[model samples]
Structures are given as structure tokens and as C-alpha cells.
Target: MPETALLPDSAAPAAGPEALDDTHYRQSFGALCEDQVVSATNAIYAENGTKLIEKGSRIDRELYARLVQHKLRDPIDQQIGIEGMVNHESLEAMAAALLDQATVPRLLAASLGRPAALLQPLRELPLPGPIALKLTLMRDRCPALLQHALATLLVAMFLADRANMPTPLRSHLAAAALLRDIGMLHMDPAWLAADRRLNAQERRHLHAHPITSVLLIRQQGGYAPEVAAAVFEHHERLDGSGYPRGLRAERISPMGRILLLAELVAALGHKFGEASPHRLGLVLRLNHRALPGALIAQLLPALQGDVLASKVQVEEASQRFAGVANAFEQWTELQQDMKPGEVRGEAFAWLNSRLAGLRQSLTEAGGPPEQPSFLLAHAAGDDLHVADALALGREALWQLGSICGHALQRWPALADAERDHAAGDAAVARWCAWTGAMLAGLPGSSVD
Candidate 1:
């Protein structure tokens, strides 16, 4: 028996408000219809919250079947707007389209041991995972649906800013958001055995699903090229420690880099309800890891919004943070990639249009310029293992500033300090000589 699915008859923890954050497990087409009915009967909560299932009786397969059949409605074509072309027919088709995602259905089928139905239409006008979730929310619960839609859009804004994607690529957002967990849908019924324990096979199956999902998306061409790349690599690690393929930092796509922002927000959003301290760690790690700092920085605020989604009092609060995050994220990325010794003419002319009017000092008035301060810090500091570097750099800069007549008179002793400021301001002069020597690799005083 696996540890996750089951324990040796241990006492269960008390259950309280359960907010389902994992979209990895989705409904069977039948389950979808049932959920619609139960959600509809709840009526008020259903629309406001997104299609959420009530806490009781949902796990009962027989009850689910009855519920779906009761709620199922025939697609009735009618005008939804000025065109009078959007009606139940369109909505039903859309619903079916969402349900047909190969990732989820295959998992569900394998678990249920049932052959999939005629699901070809689902492949035609594919909606992204975020879009599909929104549609589900709308159909089953309107308010919840609105909340989800708003969050997805806001998350995307931050992601785009960081990824250098334009706003018009909303479809990319939809695809990435929607298709994120398609691979998990195909798990055996025993997999979710959410009761109390996990068997060995279930755990193995769980680890394998994320990789399987990437392949499933590939078959459908269901997502944008970058969107799919992100889905594939969202679980990958910066130190080449993550799964499916433990790809290094350089191989991951920009889209994959940014996709991690959304994944973190979504994954840990529910934990905030339980008041987990880990929420902050999850938020920080998604970007702090091998993901690109430029884009990930912009996403920080949006991820915060998702974390606070249930608790915030602000109206459409996501957009504001997203805008700020995106701007800085883009700025960071540009400086990182700018060539250290390239011509100002060709590089400047080629990338000028892509700059989006942000402030960057890529080249000096004469030609290629010195590196940006942040990159310089990384070059000088140890980056991931940067504690000593950070401390020493702080000390060095302070000493340098004093020498240049720019620093405060008194300075505190720092951890990385190898000597006291016993020499007072004259220490700055000594530090300058030391730094110059180190840069020239001449000897004498060491920097560490």
C-alpha cells in the first residue's frame, strides 16, 4: 500500500470547509452533467462561485449519475445577443468541447475503464483550461465563475508582461490556463481514493500524470507553442531537479518560464483558506527558482491576488498589480539578454520596436555599454549561494561610497567583514585599492 492513499487505520483529521484547488481531477462527461444539476439546484451559490460541488454525497457514483440525468438539457439554438446566434446550443457545444479535453478524459476513461465517447468536436475549437474552467463556473455557478474568469485574466496580464507576450494573446492565456492539468484526468478511480490513504501504484501514477499531460497536449496541438512548452515544463526545476524532463535553465522557453507563475498562484491559492504558512514559500519559490527573474517578478503581485482572491475587498484587484509586475519583469529580462559587447547600431535598431517604451540602458551614447547593476551583482555575487557575496558586496559598496565622499560617517560591522572600520573613512581608500587589485588579480587583500 502507498502512504498517500492510505494509512494503517489511523484517525482522520476533522473536515471543515473544503476548497478544491486541484483541477488535475475533472468530471467525467456524465459527472459534468450531474455537477451542473446539483450546482443549478443550489442556484444562488452555483453561479456566484463557479461550478462548485457541495461537500456531501458527491463521491457517490450512482447519485452522480442520477443528478446529471436530471440536470441535462438539450441544446436549444437561440439568439444570445444582437446576432441572436448565441444560445443553449452554442453553450452546450462549448461545454462538450471543454469536457472532451484529451488529457482529462483519457485519465478518466482509464480510471473508469470505459471507452471514451464520440468526442471529436472537442478537438475542433479547443478552449484553454482557464477558459474551460470559467465556462464550467458560469454553467454551474455564476459568481464563482466570474471570480475565476477575473483571476485568470489578471494572472495572464502579469504573465504576459513577464513573458513579453502581448495582450492580444489572450487565447494563449486561455489555452495554458485550461489545459494545465489534462493529463491527470485519466487516472484510475482508485487514484483519487481521497478517503484516507494511497496505495503504491496510485503514487506512481500521480507522479507520471504531469508528463503524460504534456504528451496529450502535443497530440491535440491544443495549445499555443509556448503555452504547451510551459505546460510541459511548469513542473521543471531551476537546478535541473524537477520532473518529466529535468531540463536546465537555458532550455526552458520564455512561455514555460512565465507559466510557472500561474501554476504557483493556482496551486497554492487554496492553501490560503487553511492559513498555511507555506503559501508564502510556494509564491516565492515559483519565481525564485530557475524561472526568469524578469517575468517572474511581475507575476508576484498577481500571484498575491490569487492567494488573496477569497479574502480581498478590492474590485478587480488583479489588474493593477499585474501592470506593475509586468513592467519591471520585462525590464529585468531585457538587461539580462543584452549582449555584453555588441554593437549599438544593429542590436538597438532591431530590438527598439520591441522595447514597449520601457526604460533600459542597453548601450551608451557612444556604443555598447557596461552591464546593468542587477546583472553585475550576479556576476560578482554567487547568485543562488549568495549569502557571503551579498554581505561582502554591501560592505564593499559602503566602504567605496565613504571614499567617494558619499557615505555616512559611522558604519556598522557586517558579518562578512574581515576587518573593523577601525581605520574610519580611510578604510574606504584601502577598500578601493583592494578592489582594484582583486579586479586586476594582482594579490594582497582578498574579497571573500
Candidate 2:
């Protein structure tokens, strides 16, 4: 939880009552650009309700800085309001307006533009008054955060309606969607903007943001109990592959499952345009039993089109992909079993040369991040032949060999061999799975 601090207010100008526009939405903390004057809509009060900035007073740069510097999650966040700023009729309208410039899938955009079907079932639900308002304000403060929240909310609502959940339950799911990631505000902004992958410590911080958001909600009580739990468990996977608390399958709550799917849908919409559902289905298939089958069944309908036969073929190919992946896994294990020693120099050089060639082949074939064209399923009218499958299998083997050999070369000394070998094994396994998925045109499990 963020702690609150009291700072003396800056001196106000003697100029009485500056022209104020009630129509213009009030800004949140840190919203001041350079010379913008702060005008308070509500009486500014600290956590303890002590008078801070007067209602009609003008807030200059010094005061704005002071307020931001001493601000905590409580007093500062509670004092500002950006709700009703957009003045939209519905949450869907607000989401559509907010994401106008964003390239979302047509299905997702349509859902946001006119969510009557999605919102109808949730109409009777009594949401907290501040839910939409807070989300709207968050849009002004952090548009990216708002974008994710809105997408998640839209997906969650759609799921809830499909499940025929009651109004109260829907309310909890909706609130959780909006506030689940609020703790991200405490994270390092630079880490969020970094283009490269996060290191271990940075990943730890990223994972903990969910719990931080939960704690913030707990500290500021008003949200439903299920809301907090759903927020906390949103990152958890049904297969126990997720972080924080690796609760699996039956251990994860229904609301948590909804949130998990919602986040995945939102991410897919942001990454792939029209292919979001196809990509999402591929991911769900890649993970197998990690996510709830029921949730996927519910979501599969909203994915625009149903390629049931194609999906079945993809699943079958995944089985074949799994077999090819196992070969690489076993190969890695065999390498690890070898006695500690320097690999022959000529052999190492030969392996690196072969690895480079394989990587080039993969590139020319448009591999890894790019899946096979018909969801990569041969049954999906793709022309992949036995030779193509053989080449893909060879690519997987070379990929594993390259990873393991690199580990040995990087740490020939006995002291570092164990750690490097473990990393190599993990990397090879991930590579094989990814390579197989790409050949199959299926989404890899790592997409999460």
C-alpha cells in the first residue's frame, strides 16, 4: 500500500476566481503538462479530510509538484475524479471513443461499439458508482492502462453473459476487470517501456504487480470480496504454470477463470488483428488442459467463425508436434548426461555452422513468431508435405543442439556448467515447443 504524506500547500495568486469551465473534465494528479493551471472540482482533502487546496484556488507548478511528490495511493487518488469527462452514453461508447485510433479486431471493435447483447445480461447488476468513473479517469491518467482495462472488461462481460451468470456475480467480474491492474501504477515506468525482455528480478517485479493491485483494493475497501480474489488470481493458470500462487484447474475460482480469459483475449486483440481468435484458439490448444475447457468452449463462439474441423485437425497436428518436441527434449537430456569436459573444438564449430544454416532456413520459411499459413494445419488446405515435416523436425533438433552446445561453450568450467546446462535444457524445450507450433501453424504456449 502507498503511504500518504502531508506537504504545505503553495501560495495562491491574489487574482480572484479565474474563469472555470465545468464542461471541461478535471485532470488527475501528474496530469499537469507544463503551464496548465489546476482547478479543483471537488474540495481537496487529505486522507484525514484536512483541507489542502482551496476549491477555487489556482494550482501552479510548485504546488502540482508538491502534491505529486507527497502523493500516496489514498489521499491523492481519492481526491481526483475524471469520471463523466468523456460524457459518453454507455461504457461501450466510451471504450469505442477511447480506442478509435487503435487497430483492434473487427469483432472486438464491434463488441465495444454496440455491446447491447453483452451488456443486457449485466444490466441488472449493481456496479459500484465509481467503477466506470475510476476507469474513465484512469484513461486520462494512463491511456494504455485504460485500453487494457476496457478490453478486459469487454471480454469479461461477454464471457459472463455466455455463462449466464447472475447480475451480482457479473458485477464482481466487471469491477475486477477495471481495477485488477491498478497496482501497475507503482511499477517502474521504464520497465514497462523497455523493448527487450525483462531479466529475472525485473520479471519478479512484473509478477508482483497483481498482488500489489490486490493489496491496494483491499486497503481501499468497497470492492466485493470476489473482485479482490479475482484480481489476485488473474495471473494464475489452471495448469499451475502461472506465478504468484500456481493454483491449477479446480483450485482457480470461476471469476478468476473469466479474468484469465479476458486478459488473453485483450492481448490477442492488441497483437493480431482479424486473426485474434484463430491465434487465441491456437494458444488454448497449445496449452492443452492448462486452461479450463469450459471457458474455451464459451469463448470459441465469440471468435467470429467456427472452424471446428480445422480446429480438430490443428489439435491432431499438435499431437504430432508434441512427438517431435519430445525428440528434442530427450536429446537435451542425453547431452546433459554426458561427462563434464570441453567439447571438441572442431565439433563445436561444426555445430555452430549447422545451427546458423538451420536458423537461416527458419527465417526464409518465415518461422517462429510467424505461424504456418493455414493455422499451419495440413488438413486446413495447407500444402505441407512429408519433406516439409522432415525439415521442420530437423530444424527442431538443430535448435536443441545449438542451445545445448552454446551453454557448454559459454560455461566450459565445471563451476558454471550445472547452471548453464539447466538454462540450456529449459531453452531447448521452449524452442522445440515454439518450433513445432510454428510448423503446425498453432499458437505456442509461451504466447501467455
Candidate 3:
């Protein structure tokens, strides 16, 4: 069997706030100049006092090689300007278009008596000059990222209105959602590629984006401290599965929780297309422990209407579910054979707890894992039922993969003399093997 690439914990020390990498950003910005006007407002310099670009220089593809080699004294974003950058007027028009054309926004608007009120929070948001410049770069260079931000902002505002949050807090939530991913602009572009498998060092770089985002927001100077706090926690999961910091439950701020959920909703819609509402409902059902139940309850109402078919093959999905069930049984039997002391060790105990939670989630989403074939067979004739089964199976498989990843990452940290190292390694290897095989066969699976 081919070995699955398990993401082990990175031993590299955390990067300090001042060490933001802009190699990829500079390259992408220079590429942007090939089509549009981008120029330096102030002279660009390296850390050693060499001037890289003159104050009024027009940045183009020719300058990219020069800019990328140096460790810049100031971030390129603060020193450069793009023509027709995103401002309040352009952002409002974009939000208005999304409200008219997007299904999620339309559904959210239907819940409100005055759908136009949704755009108010976005309009009132304070987009300082630096923030507008970053947004413009994102729009021109990474259009999908900007769309995601706008989608998140719209959904977050809808939720905030439903909760009757004060206007100031609502605006802060909007800012948090809009700017949550600005840190990605500074990361290596290869690390963010959807099809690429990340090495541990690359994964570390990807995970530290939240910290980088917080620093950028602080540097921009107009956002509230809460906006930065929310941005920091946007990737966090309530059950402590999230990264950069594995904060759980109430340690995540109120606005942080809202942004996290909103981001998930936006990402799901982007990934699943017309069937996003259906897929999102199943994901929320299976991940109640990882997300806030109250937020889920509030969001569920918007997805209540009819959903388009997901186009997943029923027979193939059933077979995949059977494969997953067999893997789960194998892990359970392996656990039963372990010595009591080994089973009680911290590492094994943690893995067992997460697996147990997944088991419960599977049971709640469908029937027991053992009976997946039976349930799927019963629902074979109805497209919606079959789609639900397929979606549920996919989510369970993804969650299982996540458990294996966490096991690999946490094993070294949780290891101790009392733990059985050989047995633990073997168990994690087996789980990764099972997850990799299952994920390999499943279509559109993004667990890795």
C-alpha cells in the first residue's frame, strides 16, 4: 500500500510578528502590473538601506526580480498604490451585485423584511487607505479570495442582525469577515494552491496566516481591537481542532465564532455550487461539536427550502460508505486489543476520544456505521435522500481524515515513557492508510 502523507507537527519555532514573508506577494503584484497600472508612492528599500525602486516608479514585470530578492524594510502594500483600488463605492456595488445574483445572499435576504438593510453595515465599514489597497490587490490578483470575503461579510451581517447585535459590533464583525484572509496575500502562493500537497514547513506557513493577518490589521490603524481578535480566531474550531492556536469553546471571542461560521458557509457555497445548502446542512449536523450549536440553529433556517440534486452517484457513494464502515470497524477492533495501560496513555486516549466523537457524529447523521448500506438502500429511489446519504458519507470520511491528521500532529507532543511507541505508531499508520485509501476513491474529496 502507498503511504499516506501524514502532516506531522513542525518543529520550527513560531515566526515573530516582524518576519512576514512577501516573496510571493511581490511576484503576484508585479504580474498584476503587466495588465494594470501599479506604482510606488514612496521609495522602496531593502533592510540594508539600498533603494529598490524610486518614489515615483511604475512597478512592472521588470521590477519583480529586483523586489523579490530583498528583505524589504517596509511591506510592499504600504509603499505602493494600484489604479482604481477598491473603495467604499466599489465595495458597495460588489455587495449589491452579490445580493442580487447569489443564492446564499438571496436566501439570507428573504429572512429579513428589508433586504436592503443588509448592505448598510457593509457601507458603514471603515476601509482605511491601506485596507482598501490590500482589497484592490486581492480583487485584481486573487479574485476568488475577494469573492469569499464579500460572501462572508454578507452572511456575517445577516447573522449579526438576527442576533440583534448593536450596529458598532455589527460593523466590527463585517470588518473582521472582510479582512480575515488578507494575510494570505503575504504567503507563498504555492502553499495556497488547491491541488498541491503541502510539506510540514509549507503547512506551517499556511497555518500562521491568522497571526500575519492580525499584524497587518493592526498596522492599518483604523480597525477596532475586536476586529483583529476576530480575524485571529476565524480559522479556529470550537472543539480545538483549529490551528495557529487550538482555542476551544469560550476562549474564542463572540465575533470570532460568528466569522468562523460565516467563512464556512461561504466556502461551502463556493465548493459545492448549487447543492451547497444541502451539503452545508449535512456538514453542520455532523460537526455540531466543532461548531456552535446556537449558530447552526440560526443558520439552518436559511437552508430550509428545496435544494438542487448534487449529482453524486448513489451506488458508488454506497460502496464508499461501506469501505469507510469497514475501516472504522478495523480501528475499533485494534483499540480493543491494546493493553489497558497503553489504551489509557494520553496519546491513545486523545485519539480514541476523537474517534469516538466521529462515531457518534456518524450515528447521528445517518444510522450506525455498520448499517450504512441498509440506510442507503432504503433511500435509493429519492434523489434528495440519496444525495443526503452521499453528503453525510463524504462529511464522515473527511472528519475521519481530520482525526488521523490530529493524531499524527499531536502524537509527538503527547508521547511519554509510559506510552507504547511502537503500538502507537502502528495504529496511526493504519488509520492514515485507511483514510488515504478512502479519500483517494471518493470524488471531490478535499480532506488532505
Candidate 4:
């Protein structure tokens, strides 16, 4: 069992009448939605001080419908703060509470399976007051969003720290992480809640969300270009398979890569109830070619080993295969000096031999590798980058090898930080330095 933290006192629900501040109220107002409770930052009334809706009232579906039908007679913005807007003072308190120990999830604590040290650097990281207020208000409308935002913030901050991202860039990353999925609020609730696989059209609509989310953030203004660009590319993949913009790894900003990885990890946890670091790492592996491997590699060290012995083994094995594939890619690049036909043939031969050995190893280990082998066999080489072809092939093989006999485990959420924690922020200033150090540290292989 791991130690856990409790939610802070300030997280307590606000009851009773309150008025939204007059100027801020209008600037941040939006339409009321079903099941969202909103309040006035300042008292609001109709033409003659007749209160139309009390402050701090929970707007149920029916009330929302009625409010919509009549447009609330008086201007909706003047009458009620539909966004549950919070002021700067409240925002600071709310941000503080997110770091409280009571807020740590138990399962996450168990997964960490070690002493819970405060991430002091993360605690000290600067967050804009307005960003916090905006995100908190957004969370009021979509309750689950806050969890995702917090999770993304945690992971992104950790990555930013590890990569030595700039301080300004780190702030933008945090903002982007919090607001990247804001467009989901505008989608149909039914669609958002559906558990089944989306049809093609539905996926296309969902794919458009990155664009919409960026637009919404821009409308709010005061955000840096880094923030807007990251939000726009958060869903994109390294291999151009991702949506709205099919951007390649080099094309995606560094913050965008971190945001993408963080978002995926957070989503996995939300869907299955627990996303252990190891599992999340495997997700990175399985999607290795499509994602930024360097960024994923940076996060691999943080995952707890052997949470389930076989799962960890599989992840390790997958990582090994990815390495071999990487070697093959580098080898192919060197072969650019050779005849194109010979290079292609040599690449195919190398891949086939590795896949054969991987299959045999999985069989001996009692893991299944047949399906991924077939997929690899079917993949068209002409369309892939030389490196991507090998990377994706290895991933498919590793996926089959890992899933052969074991069920993918979903750990229960026993504990988690209620709010973000403090961790070192120096990475924000030294990402390039770290990158240079890392590349220099890698052992070079002979091209021959």
C-alpha cells in the first residue's frame, strides 16, 4: 500500500448567492449547458432589479433549455456568469490546492511504490493567474476535463523538466496542456460519452477538434504563439498519420510532442481507470514510429518496473526491438551510398531475419507474435520512410509478442495528487543543453 494525499479545503463546493465581477463576467461569458452550475461574480438583475436567476444556482438541463428559449430576456452575460468564472485571488488558492498531498491518487502512489517526495520544482513553476481562472471555469462546465488537464500538466511538467525546456516555453506547455481539448466542450454530449468505436465520420469530426480547440484559445487571447501552436499540433503524430495536419516529427514543436504524449497517457488512465507509467510507456512503444521516440525515451525512466512481471518484460522487449529497428534505420541511411535496389533488398532481408527471430523468441516465451508478424508482412514499404518502415514493423512484431499470453492489466486508481506538485524547472532553460549532452552520450556504431 502507498501513502496518499487528501483534497484541500478550498476545493469545497461554493454555495449561496454570489455576483460575478461586472467587466470580467461579460468578457468570459458563454452559453449555459445542462448540468453545469454557474454564478455571478457580481449580483445581476433585470431592468428594475428583479432577479432573473439567483447567483450560485445549479443550472439543470431544463433551466438551461428555458434560458436558451427566451435568451434570458436581459443579456445573459449581464444576468449570470454562465462560465462559473473565478477571480485571480480564488484562482491562486485553487492552484495551490492542486499540489496538496490529499489529492494524490492511491493507485498512482502504489505504482510509484516508493517514498512520496514533494516535487518542489513543479510547485515553484509559474502559472499565469488568468490561465488558471480560465481552465477552472472550463472545468466547471466539463467536470472530467479538470482531471485530464491536471494529469497532462503533471506529465508535461515532468517532461519539460527532463528536457530542459525554456521557462517561457514551459508556461506555454502548461497552458496548452490545460486547454488543448477545450473544443470537446462544443461537441455533442452524446458523442462525447459514447463508449463504442466512432464511425469514420465521427472520427473526422473528432479530428477537427485540435483546430477548434486552438481557435477557442486564440479568442481568449494573451496566449503566446508557442501555446497556440502546441495546442494545434497536440494530436499530430511524428509520422504524419495524425489528424487535421499529418505533421511529421520535425514539424511538430517540442512542446507539442510533450503535450501529445501527456495527453495520450492521461486519456489511457481515464479510459481504463488506471494508466500505470509502465503501461503508458508501452503505449509510447507501440506507437513509437508515429510519436517522438526521443521524448518517449525521456519518460521511460520514470515508470515503475515489474508492476506485473510479464508486462514489464514485454515493454523491455519492445524497447529492445525498437532499438534494433533504429540501428537498421541508421544502417539504411549509410547505404545511401550503395545501389538503390541493393539497399532496398538488404533492408528487407535484415527486417525479415529480425522478425523471424522475434517470432521464435515470443513462441519460446509463451507470448503471441503471429498477428503482428502478419501485419508487418502486409505493410507496404514504398510508402514508409526507411526508418519508419523498420520502426513500425518492429512495433507490430513486439505488440504481438507482448500480448501472446497475458491480459493487459489495468491497475485500480488507489491514490493520486489532488493538485500538481513542485518539480525542478531548470529543464525549461536547458532543453537544448540536455539534448546535446544526450546525443554526445550515445555510443556510436560503425556503419560497416
- lDDT to native, each model: 0.37, 0.53, 0.76, 0.48
Error of 1 at 396 (Å): 31
Candidate 1 residues lying further than 4 Å off, grouped into runs, are 1-27, 31-153, 168-170, 189-200, 274-287, 299-448
RMSD of each: 21.7, 12.2, 6.5, 18.0
Q: Cα miss at 173, model 4 (Å)?
A: 0.9
Measured with C-alpha atoms, the lDDT of residue 231 in candidate 2 is: 84
lDDT for each residue of candidate 3 in 1-448, tens digit (9 for 90 to 100): 1101111124222334345666676677777789888788899999889888899898888885667566899866678887898988898889888877777777788777577777888888898767888888789878888988998998888888878889888888989899989989988766666677765456667778887787677667787778877888898899988876888886788888889988988888767666777888999888999898898898888876547765668876786688668767878777777776553456556777777788888887777887768669767788888888888877777777666666656554322335545665556556666666777777655452
- After TM-score superposition, what is the CA distance of residue 345 in candidate 1 from its true location, in Å? 53
Error of 1 at 190 (Å): 5.9
lDDT of 2 by residue, 1-448 (tens): 1111100012111211121111112334344323343455456766555677766556654565666444332444344433244333455565555345433324543544555654443344334433444454456566777678767877787778768788778877877887888766656556666254454456666777776666656556676678777887788877565656667777667888999878877866676554455555554544445567777776655564522222234444444445444544444454565457534344334433444543344444434312433224444444333323333433344344334433334333312324543433433434433443444453332222
Better of 2 and 4 by lDDT: 2
Candidate scoring better on lDDT of 1 and 4? 4
Q: Total backbone clashes of model 3?
A: 0
Which one is best on TM-score? Answer: 3
lDDT against true structure, model 2: 0.53
For model 3, the superposed segments whose C-alpha errors exceed 4 Å read 1-17, 42-56, 61-76, 309-313, 339-345, 377-380, 411-421, 443-448
The alpha-carbon lDDT assigned to residue 101 of candidate 1 equals 35
lDDT of 1: 0.37
For residues 1-448, could you state the per-residue lDDT of candidate 4 as single tens digits?
0101111123112211121112322222234344345554344454566565666765554554455345233544344444545543443344344433312223333334432221332343334444444455556655566666666666676677668787666766877776787666555545565344444456555776776666555445676777767887887778665656667887777778888887876666454333254345545666666677777776666554323322122333334344444433443344454453342333234333434544554433323343333323333343222223333433444343222111111111111224221121121112222322333343321100
Predicted structure 2, TM vs. truth: 0.62
What's each prediction's TM-score?
0.37, 0.62, 0.86, 0.52
